[model samples]
Target chain A: MKETLLPSSIKNKEKRSAVHAKLKQQKKVEKKRNQKVREAAEKKALELGEDPPPKKTPRTIENTRELDETVCKPDDEELFAGNDADEFSSILKQECIPKILITTSRFHSSRGPDFIEDLRSIIPNAHYYKRGTYDLKKIVEYAKKKDFTSVIVVHTNRREPDALLIIGIPNGPTAHFKLSKLVLRKDIKNHGNPTSHQPELVLNNFTTRLGHRVGRLIQSLFPQDPHFNGRRVVTFHNQRDFVFFRHHRYIFETKESKTPEGKDKKENKAARPGKVVARLQECGPRFTLKLTSLQNGTFDTQGGEYEWVHKPEMDTSRRRFFL
Target chain B: MPRTTTVESPGCPPLRALTFDSLGLVKVIEAHDGQDGGAVKMVERWGDPDSSKCVLAASILDRESDPLVSVARKCGSIEVISAINGDLRAQIPNHGDEDDAITGLHLFSKQQSESSSRACKLFTCTTKGHARMESIELGGTVAEFVRDPSPTVWDVCGSGNILCSKIDGNENYALFGGKGVEVNLWDLQKCVKIWTAKCPPKNTLGIFTPTWFTSATFLSKDDHRKFVAGTNSHQVRLYDISAQRRPVISVDFRETPIKAVCEDIDGNTIYIGNGSGDLASIDMRTGKLLGCFIGKCSGGIKSIARHPQLPVIASCGLDSYLRIWDIQSRQLLSAVFLKQHLTSVVFDSHFRKEVPVPEVTNTVEEAEVIETPAKRKKGFKDEHTSKKKKSKRSSKKRLSDDED
Candidate 1:
């Protein structure tokens, strides 16, 4: 269109930087000639059988959220009898085993004991402690008198570790979170150490009801049988409410290239020639969490009972959310 | 009259309520006149999800002609049931051989008996301080094996714990409170105690503040000497008992532990909730606060009720849902969920009043067009009078709280 009136009436010193690099090379050749005429009209409308164009959807705030009538309806028998009577239902029915404890927030720093030693090697029977001058309600009454079925804490601030808490033990629902992008395990990249077995988890979306009680308080911090031959795992995922975490380990391999480049080349010749693929690896200590406040027992920051708190006017709406 | 014909269905105003949870289930919700998320209905569960039959204190006798409810549990019995078809009817053992626990149940009515029957009672209390009562009866114009099951117990506050009670409004005096216990009161026809409170001083860092009390009530409707309570540290307080035994107001709110307080039938507001799902509403004659109640209740509100002629309010807790709200636009007019943790709710108030009452007069004309013209200019400076006494004395001074 006359190069948008020829680069602002070519007013500059070096002739308007050569007409703004010739109008950005004529708008990258008119956007690759309009993407090769929309891929030759979608390959001549699939060789003329017609109907090949309806693809656009991308408006994501997790597919425009804001409807949430407490979601969780996969055959909700009163949300499975309220998760078979909560408080992590006796370590989720394995009839009790959790343990955890972990600690930190009391003027602690050095990357908060290296992120609670990478969350005590990704939470199994966890342990850690040393938050010296006590008082997280006295380490939740000394981890509920040592039977500690979860406590966590972490917290730090300038040297990083930014906040975590958890709690649960001896009648509690605690939670708290907010920690952020950490990385640890010697800053990742090909990382992979984990193992004393237990890992497995996964979790993902957690669909509402306060993301299923913060996904059963992060599934009562591990251990209810998950040694999957230690191929480790540990996910948490939960998209729009933040969570994320990660860690991995799988293996399988075999399929190196059967035409796997990009655009479906006829669905890559329907793969299968020596298939196997799996792979994964990155077992570092990445992080994210978000929650902010769940409380209900245990660590009483002066009276405890909050079953959900995170407010800034509950973020008004960018597709509102609350895990 | 074909059940007085009404069902005007457009959605929003047919509530019913009844809750009670922590596993010994009980549900009942309802919501009809069309919808807006309703239908809960479990109606009876009672323990054995592998022990700890929880249900720590319930209540709902809705001035019975049949309804009933009671609950109590944590091993100390009480039961009752019947709110229409959930049956059971009686039980009553309480403080079950003494390991203590029940923490307040309530019911109340006790008066009829000249063989025409009626009676009522229940009460309960516990977490060590005990308190009992019992009666029930109901049957009337004769025969259910000549009724009378007997219960009595009433040691009232022989020691601490107590958790919370209430009674008042002419049921003569009850109050209680808990944790390190403080607010006392008692005298439900001579069960004793009478007035106690006291604590509050120290803090210029001199520490002191601890006398727990997690939830108490009675602010008005026949006073019994004022009171309010809440605490476990999120404070609230109020008290009075004919002027100062301590808390003549106090305040705090919002670090959690208030767990349900209620008050407002124009008793100078109150509400509370806390333990985190924060419900708010304060005032109690200027100790102030007020706003909160919009949506957020993931759990911990344990029971709020309010609707003795609907301005709404329901609540429930530990996030098993139930909600309701609309105390003049404190909003959230309907929620439901009902999975478990609940712990007590109530409000049946002749629910669909003989089938509808024109969907409760079209929800009092959609709560008077969703209220808020600065609360209809602080109670009718003449919106042409009698909209039922200006919506019942401008929705009788509001306040409510939950999360226990």
Candidate 2:
């Protein structure tokens, strides 16, 4: 057996254990004294018919630590709870026409005039505003006066139209997108006639981290409340993280009348009379957007590295839309 | 140790203001005049010197009469100490729960009766959205507790949602901000909420929410119904309870979140401080950035207090330095290292005569001497000796100024 070198080792276990026992006894005595003092205070308070003073909780250093952790966790269900899909979809019944005002930066290249003309062909209701005093407040004021639902601001950097900032009227959920490819309607010669139907909006494969931001930006670009007179129906769908966008016309039509059977006649007699029913009809001029890449905080459609996957087949009635 | 030796030999000016920091130390500093850096003397130090209980908020009560400094600690204990002697007058334990740190301390006077004198009421709010009002009699008896109902919306956030505010003249109104909740004006007299301005929805896509307000102040004496808030979103928002529910004015100031905000005496200018140590003055009417005050503040500023009758503002924060800046010139006048992270500062506005005028010639000579490297090396030793003599002479002069 090895000899214990230290004085406070197991060789002197009895002494060490005795010291520990002494400490334990002292602690017990202290605790009892504290309890007695507290009881005495409480009894005195009771005699006086007053509440005893609240006990002082011991101070801890953790109290000074920063408490905010809600900003990082976006998946918190409570934050997403109030977003009612029905309430949002109800906007389609209110605003159908998408009247847009196009305003480019004052310091743009010669290509700006030609681009504006091309945009007018694609969006017939779009109006061009000569950029003069490019202040956000002034621009918003002008757009309000013109009664435009959305204001599209084309920002130029180094003589290149590199970004598009879209702000909805009245109150904003503003969206900024990167402009790329610069393809005009005339450049795609094989493309069908412009007057054949309404432009189809196709938003494709915007699913990555950067893609989600772009997708949300595009979604907010549309007005929160739709104009029913415009007969516009905007669709946003995501499948396996690939978001898709389409804009089409929708009209409400009265369903055809049919003679009631014996069981239906009994139910009809019990129910209130004269309820008008309408069915939704989807129409033409669809726009398609294929989001290929994101650069400089904007959606870029020209990047060729985008991985194209076959569109998933599903019943339209059974499919759920993301936005 | 002799009291005079400990108190007087440091050659610092007399104390005109008191502040408490997160280290649980209370320091009494001399107030600065409008020109530049003034003398800061730690005349009396109190509380747990080892910093066992971090001081969260502090306010000086009855500055015009019986001056008392009330400090709220992180452990939910509130201690009132004398401003002159640092004697503990009253200690209330468990004023709030341990998990809920006190966020603000406001002192207001309320008339108790027709025959009795006015009593000082201390209103405190905790991170847990608990608000309590306690009436303290002249004899240091603390009683008459009034607590507001816990805001149900903030229940899930717990201590993450902190509330801070300033009390109105009669202690009848409190304007406070809650994280991700709303800015609410409460009627403390009736213990009811008056109105609420909901926080704007964040613009981020499913992540990176905007920060809540860290500090706020009423716009001015003329418009008590409106207030300005410095938010973690790096924006200054002005809300008028009389107007619409949304903010009346919103302007982005900087990239870093704003930590402190105060309105100027005229109410047309707003002073703001950010977490990155940038202090700026903004024109409230035009919404234009006036200028930034350059200082040696490496850490975030926690509190900003302007002089009652001067163009100077004093600020203290994590850098452990109390800095005085001239709002007109945008120059740092003085910086005093207190060796503790300061959380709150309150000026003794009643002690008006204690302010010291800036010594222009002395600073100009020092600047010139620093420019010449050859002369600086030779004058370094002489400068130290002269500085000590000047400090002694200035201390005597400061005493005379106080007499005036």
Candidate 3:
């Protein structure tokens, strides 16, 4: 009746590969024919005043994520009330300007300072301090006395910048993040230089309660009033609980049309003239951050209470995300 | 594999608890297991509007009358509110400045209060060793709240901050411990020190272990001499005053310091939660770790309270979620996100007073999984004989080693 033996079952290797390739090509042609037939059917149905077939959505980790109860809902009175009294409320309300003090761990690495230098260029009113055998607790005390609103500590291991600690001033809710995939400004191609004006902050995919708190913490590192004229933007995009940091500058450009040698280009231009398009040129220093722990108070490892701790067991499901 | 229990099972009631947040917000949470998953919700909320006046410590005084919640503010003020309605029953203004914040608040009834059985005394202690006790009665038909009279104040002789203070079941002794402070047991009747925990000897590095006790609790409900204290160095020390001044058994937990410790109703087991959200149960008899509780908490556990009757415990923390866990299964039963960093939590034993028969029957049925009385008796007998034989063998081995 039909040849039941498959190409993979062929005894000769050369013959098996040849048959396999031929079968693949035949299958490709068949798929195209079936796609055409389906499209024609859909087109004919539309022309006959009938609805087209429904679109099939592709399955993805984000779309098929487990249901999370902590996802923030709009018009939640309790969440709003809690946010109003949070530690970053003053900075978020624009009542106080955020003055950040950035430093590295006790043992310094070459790349750590370079990363801090790039960070200083991005954050306004940020000053870098050299860590020289000074205890973090002592530095926190000093920063509090000096009226610094926040402290950022970069920790390096094996000559690579690995961890970041951000502590809110006076009172705290310290956050520790594992940093990776760092690309400096000089390494990125076609990267633009950042302007002195405060860049606008965009937090994306921060839907859960913990994500909202982390978003607010990152937001407090920058000034509340942004200069739109600068066209510079800093975005913290969270996907699968990894926060990707990106800086970009945007520009508006006019759309251009291409015409055939003998075609009438005027008709194409008359339909839509000067269609404007926005383009972004990235300013470098790209990185990814995964939160490790969130402490309730300042960076006191011995006694401070952590609000959340990342453990190996927490990664039970690939689709389960905290942020 | 965790079974989510439902309150729909005729006589089973939902777990009711009170939680306090960092901004002085108090919420009453109710939770039950549903077919789909655990369903937890906040039923009531009330607290000081001034966010600066953070809540430090809180306790629920549940007696024959309506339960009262005592919330101690960071500014040293204590507010007593009706647990049922969140109505302020009494407000005691700040006793001292902000630095002298209240560290402990305990409410207990005195034996001499038989004349006014509803009257309970509130014990409050501050970081500066100031202790005060005031009688408060919330049983009256008065429309307006009455102000409490002047309290009897004393000083606890301690060198450093008294971070925690807890009273024994009989209300005869109070245990005080804190940063740089050793565990001290004081007789509530005489107000004199009964026992003091000695400092542990030096370690291998010739360094003395710091005496910073973050949390302490009694090993048993009635035994004041057997105490368990957790230190800031991630060590849990069990002390039996009748045995020795030093700890009989000391075990190290995970890296982070232990923030909260609670004894199980069984008295042989203790649940200790550390700053890093690790909740583990240890058998106090042998100081061996039992399995850790399932369902990890995201934040440092601040308070753990065992239900007076149920085989469950409720724990809340800076993560702001109130979680109820079944003690026998060591599995999380239900969790409610409170939306604020919770500072403390307490179970409402008298949440619904309509039915008592079903609850009494439930305790026995649930305990069947662990063991029945007859089964336990046979097992105990076997264990006793085995233990005696093992002790004799160990002594003989010790003697041989000594001779060699």
Candidate 4:
């Protein structure tokens, strides 16, 4: 009768209950196995000094197709902010002197040759190139061979210098800017003459639109000297969106020796030279430039569409001096 | 292997546009045999907009007799065009939201029997964490669309995730990795999670942070259980399904991030291209750099595709040039200035060659030599040493042959 009952236990209801119990037991075993795996993973993560493993969410078809806007929106915002900050930070750390080449359009030369002379006085080290025809390829090749750091091409329309095309050397970013209200410093304002002391430069208030390229251009105009021996320091300050260029020179003077003991005392004091021993002179050629517009990629200024706008001011309180 | 000559075209078509905005357009140039010379002509160009919406991902559907090319746009549209001539066959607009960009597109055939009704499946994933699988019949019409239930937690922007692999020789699985450390594998047939592999955290400043994978591919057709990935931190990692949570093998390749990666036909070598326009072939077993293909790329390489049956590789990138190179010789065979930045390229496996027109009697011999049994055996024993000797011998033979 027990055997009959045991066989009858395989009846549909009884069989279903037995199968359910078996499944429950199987699930329990699986839970234990997963617990073991989780513990092991946690221990491994601890050993590596990492955060615990993320919770394993069961994969579902609905979850995979669900569009989560909140998660991606923050990431996009963060990426944009990060890129802008990185570009600014990288531009600030650059320090190199630029070798500039200045060229004028044929229209500018036809208008007057005095503009070239005036530009030469402002940037003494810039090499002047005569404009014959507008061949960008030939000019770029020539600039490369001359090892110029930057090329400043002035374009004139109807006898008025209208725009400036600045191209960096060896495939750097090119920028175009419209020039307005040109003024040449005719009178040599007698601030003072430079002596034999080293000088320092301060470029203040320049906006950060193409600030790095502009800063590089200004720095390259100066000589690459240690300034231990007296060197001229130029400062470019942009106020009211106009770049004001200033130059200063300092001369170091040695004290007269009274006796051998006095000379020894002077030598000991040489390491901490004060302002009493150095004299600063402001050399005049100060000028201001109003950058009307800026655009990326090379522009001919003669051909193609020209769209110029006044450059907006950037916060310059953080960047007081660019040396 | 048979040596096939690529005939040169007499006169190339003028590139109508040179603006950088044209980078958004995708063109496929077809070479047709001509009487005097073979003319390579643009068969189709998709996306004629001057706006900034670019192609994010594209896949060539080569399963059927007539292949189709599906391109995913940044504006959340998928366009299917005929491979023969650029004609819109089907278009799926608004696959994702306007702001949501599709990161990956893959085409694979279902494992169902021919009698059971075979159809091609198109799988797409977006940066918004959406994965959708659509079934398309042989005539380029959508039959059904199924979306996966479980989405990945990782951000898929810029990182190349959403890859399809054949699992257990029959079942198809899609693998996705993102900014998160975990890589999820999903069974496409059941639309359920199969397994997950957790990538090891990057050790930065004594802190463990997740490293995102930029590109990934299965090791080979035979070794479907294992896959390789290139990370944003310039690491090449290998993961095995049967292995533990961590990647089985990892190696640092370069300082710049890797943008594109592809495996050789035999699966023993991996070709990787980084952001600095550098392409290198790496040995899988020893994790050693075999050689770098020099002087071809001038910008970041966006994609690399290997020929289905030939020892040729086609690479296109931000440099706006499509270059074909010989894998063994590491020599640039041909280059075409496409005048626009190319994000991806795929060869038509069913491309038929026209009858060779007898124009010039002295035809340039195509250099497509297959390795013989004896040479292959010699190659197996100390490959590096044999390769050096072979190169030296080839140079000397070429010199003598030229003199003769």
| Cα lDDT of model 4 by residue, A77-168, tens digit | 42233223321223233344456788877657543355555555445457788877857657867887877766777778887666666776
Q: How high is each candidate's TM-score?
A: 0.33, 0.45, 0.84, 0.46
Stretches > 4 Å off in candidate 4: A1-323, B1-24, B30-47, B50-53, B111-119, B138-171, B201-205, B356-404
**CA displacement after TM-score superposition, residue B36 of candidate 1 (Å):** 8.5
lDDT tens digits, residues B1-404, model 3? Answer: 22234233121236678888877888888654442344557877886445666789998876423577888987677888767667676777886676888888987744355785446688888887787777766433223344457777778854788988888888888888988789888887787888888999999999997789999999989787898999999999999989998999999998988989999777878989888888888999999998787675778888899888788888888777788887777877777787777789888775542223367766664355123211111222344454654443433343343233
**Every candidate's CA RMSD:** 24.9, 28.4, 12.6, 30.7
**Best-fitting candidate, scored by DockQ:** 3
lDDT for each residue of candidate 4 in B1-404, tens digit (9 for 90 to 100): 21134233233211111111123566765544342243344455655643345677877765323366777776677777655544565667774458767777876544344652334556777765567776654432243322334433333224443432223223376666655435666776677776777757647666764556677777776666677787777788777888866788888876666778888878778898876567888887778888988652545677888777767677777555676667887766556656445678887654544345355621421211111101111112233554655453543344343233
Global local distance difference test of model 1: 0.72
What DockQ values do the models have?
0.21, 0.01, 0.39, 0.01
Interface quality of candidate 4 as DockQ: 0.01
Q: What lDDT does the true structure give each of the candidates?
A: 0.72, 0.58, 0.81, 0.57
Decide which is better by DockQ, 1 or 4: 1
- Maximum-TM-score candidate: 3
Q: Rank the candidates by lDDT, best first.
A: 3, 1, 2, 4
Displacement of residue A228 (Cα, Å) in model 1 is: 23
- Give the range of the ten consecutive residues with the poorest summed lDDT in model 2 chain A: A302-311
Residues B38-140, model 2: lDDT tens digits: 4555555665453446788888764443467788887788877666556666666874356877887876655545563434566778786777776654433
